[model samples]
Target: MDFSGAIFEGGAYFLKAKFEGGAYFLEAKFEGWAYFLEAKFEGDVNFSGAIFEGDVNFSGAIFETRGMFAHVEKIEEEVKFSGAILNRVFFEDTDLTKIRFYGTAIENAYLAGANFGNKRFIEEREAIDEERNLLQHITKALKKPGLKSILKSMFVFFAFPDNSYRKIKTKCKPISEAFRRAEDVYRNVKLSLQNEGDYETAGEFYYKEMLMRRKRTLYEIKNLKYWLFSHIYSKLCGYGEKPLRVILAAFFVILFFGTFYWLTGTVTGEGITDSSFDYYYFSVVTFTTLGFGDIHPVSFTGKLATMLEALTGAFMMALFVLVFGRKMLR
Candidate 1:
């Protein structure tokens, strides 16, 4: 039954209608309310590029096989799938602002590239809260408790792919409010996965969760002391990933202080004249706090530089040791 390019000027109903073969609704336009309540599709179904100008309901409907509902251009009002059994449904590259999946069993559903636009996020949150409240009422309608619970959990887990995580991260990369929303969703998903005992997948989500938290700290929270500390920690040790960053920082510090010592001309020694090599060597010696007694600072600037460099060197060396130990242990 192909309704491709068909236009419905008023409300349309397919209530309790059963399609035993292939069904197509490509490019169909629904100008008023669209109903598919309890409709059953026994074979493949396609609804690509459909435009729903008014509310559409598929409550209690069943898709027994694969279904395509991608690239929907617009849905001016709510499109609900509550209590619908959607099997291997594809909803990619669609604006999902008005879509709701409460109480839906979406097994192996793919939602890649779907845009849950920010405008509907508040409504979506409210819907989720309402659904949570209504769960008690809906639980009484369930026939098989264990199987439904397992299938629903699996559906929730597979509805969003790992690449979807990257999409959320990229979309929320710049704005703090968007990132907060992304983080909230990410943390919820991670917790759900953990609760399901899927530790491996949960670990990946946990990493993303921490990364979002770090980004939120850097961009949204605006805590100065923590920001500064985290910034320095990342640069010096790459958050404990790249030890070479510490080495580079140490080299830069040595060069800067060495130049300062040479310019001040404050070091006096028996053989160390106004030579660049002598100044650099003396700088390294002072930084390491190895006072050989042959070369000493003759001025206040040199002494101050020596003290500062020594403290910096001590801190850097300790940090390197700690980071290196962590890496080796890991």
Candidate 2:
């Protein structure tokens, strides 16, 4: 189905939809929340100049030909192409603030026109270009030398370019062995741009997706000058922690509940300002797995809170056990 010259200006899409043949969204834009979740694309899909304001979920899609998202122009929210299969992809000239390529595979990709949307990345262009030149020179030098030429082609094809590096490594063992020494450079390029707030962030994510495929991890080091506020906020806001962090998270969540209690109690002077004490006490009891019925809640919201605390306690304890098991056993 040719959707070229058509505009998909809606917020909702049918779940698990299937589109065969080449579907073109060349210059078409998705202006709001959209979903192609579990949708399958069975041919070449072009999304050049398309804009995604919300989440993109092509979870079980198949791009038999190639998928081009080059010059995406704008992607305001997170992009998830997880669990999808692609033959090739182009993402040059995109504004991707946050991207995740978890569990996705691109077999053979060309990223020639791609740009990471920043100046620091622009600065690295010369160094990358120099590496490209060196690759070309080597490719020609070992051209006539039998096995050496095969090794040389591997060096040029899998070494410098950002896209097909890992795919080539997994498919071509001979080439993979020849450039084993360059693994650090490959890892560093991915690690450098792993958690950038600027354009470097997306580049790192994209590069990692290409290099490691499903086994990729995004590296994030809090920038002291920039992320000071955010780091403090996450710590204060329950994120990516277990065991004691779980306990701390419960305390903060209940703190928010206590704050709500304090503000609302002032509205009716007889209302419970005492819920503050109850919040901490409940969290503590919940953390310790106590099932006492003495200080029981009366309101329906309070009952819901009790259930939530109980569930949170169970989750935290499980997390504690799982995470600590890995550390202690290892």
Candidate 3:
């Protein structure tokens, strides 16, 4: 069934609807609530370039074959997909921050350029209260028995439906089910991007997934070890996704050991000198394992520090290579 360019001014209710063949909704506009609860699609379903201006729901819907829901400019309200079965769906080049995927089943979904929740949760949640309040007021007024009250309600809605009914603000509260659901969605998206061979984007999603887990473990689960491990991983190398972090880490390690050697004093051909550059040079040489023998550590603490610097340098060099290579290849 083709619904291309159709306008759902009031709403698009397809509750429990069944489509035996391909279902198309290309470039359709939904100006109000859109309900597809428990709907079934036997073949490919397309909704490319659709516009949703209000609440959207696809709870418990099933797509038996490939589906497309791409190229949407924006969605004014949070989209509910709780318990939906999305099989081989494409959501490329779409903003996905407002999409709630709680309990949703997904397989082989393409989400390239689809944004998951970031710091915009608070910003988005705050922006929608005006429209929501206006709508609630209108709904409550229209429920009265008198026709005059209904007209007055409609007038009030037209006049005070502020914020242009365009966008809504949304933020996921901490230690809530929404937070956990978002974490799950991030994990699924990360795996899906990985399967698509988009490793760089996959790495970003992986970072978000790990971040969500870290926050949950720290705040809700209260697991100190897990939180510490995750925090260290992020601080050290951004979970293997950031080459710059690795580079910075190496720089700091070199500087730290160089300062240590300078303070402890190293022996040279002319005997120990207080020159900072000399100790720094010795530190670099020892770190790279390029022992020049022109300068050596006489103190036991200095010698032990050299060995430790060598091990750290090797590890940092290896890490930099790995992360840099991944970034370049991706």
lDDT of 2 by residue, 1-330 (tens): 766556566675747877777778887767666676777777778988877777767766677777888778777887776666666666544543355454566555444333332211101111222123223322232232231212211112221213333343343333333333233334433343332222233233233233322111111222344345434433432222223565576566656644543444321223224457754554466455695544555566666665776786677567657645643442
Instruction: Please write out the lDDT profile of model 3 over residues 1-330, one tens digit for every residue.
Output: 999999999988899999999999999989999999999999999989999999999989999997898888779997887778877777766777688766676666555445543313221122222212222322332233331112211111011112321342222342333345445655665565566565666687677667767765664555799889899889988988887887787778888888887765644545346668877787788778888788887878877888898898888888889878878877
Question: Residues 102-201, candidate 1, lDDT per residue (tens digit)?
Answer: 6676776555555654322221112111112212211221222221232132343121111222334343334455445545655665565556665444
Q: Candidate 3: which stretches are off by over 4 Å?
A: 117-271, 281-330
In model 1, the runs with Cα more than 4 Å from the true position are 1-174, 181-211
Error of 1 at 62 (Å): 9.6
* Every model's TM-score: 0.48, 0.37, 0.54
Q: How far is candidate 3 from the true structure (C-alpha RMSD, Å)?
A: 14.1
Which residue pairs in candidate 1 collide? none
Candidate closer to the true structure by TM-score (higher is better), 1 or 2: 1
lDDT (CA) per prediction = 0.67, 0.48, 0.67
Candidate 1, after superposition: displacement of residue 241 in Å?
1.9
**Rank order (by TM-score, best first):** 3, 1, 2
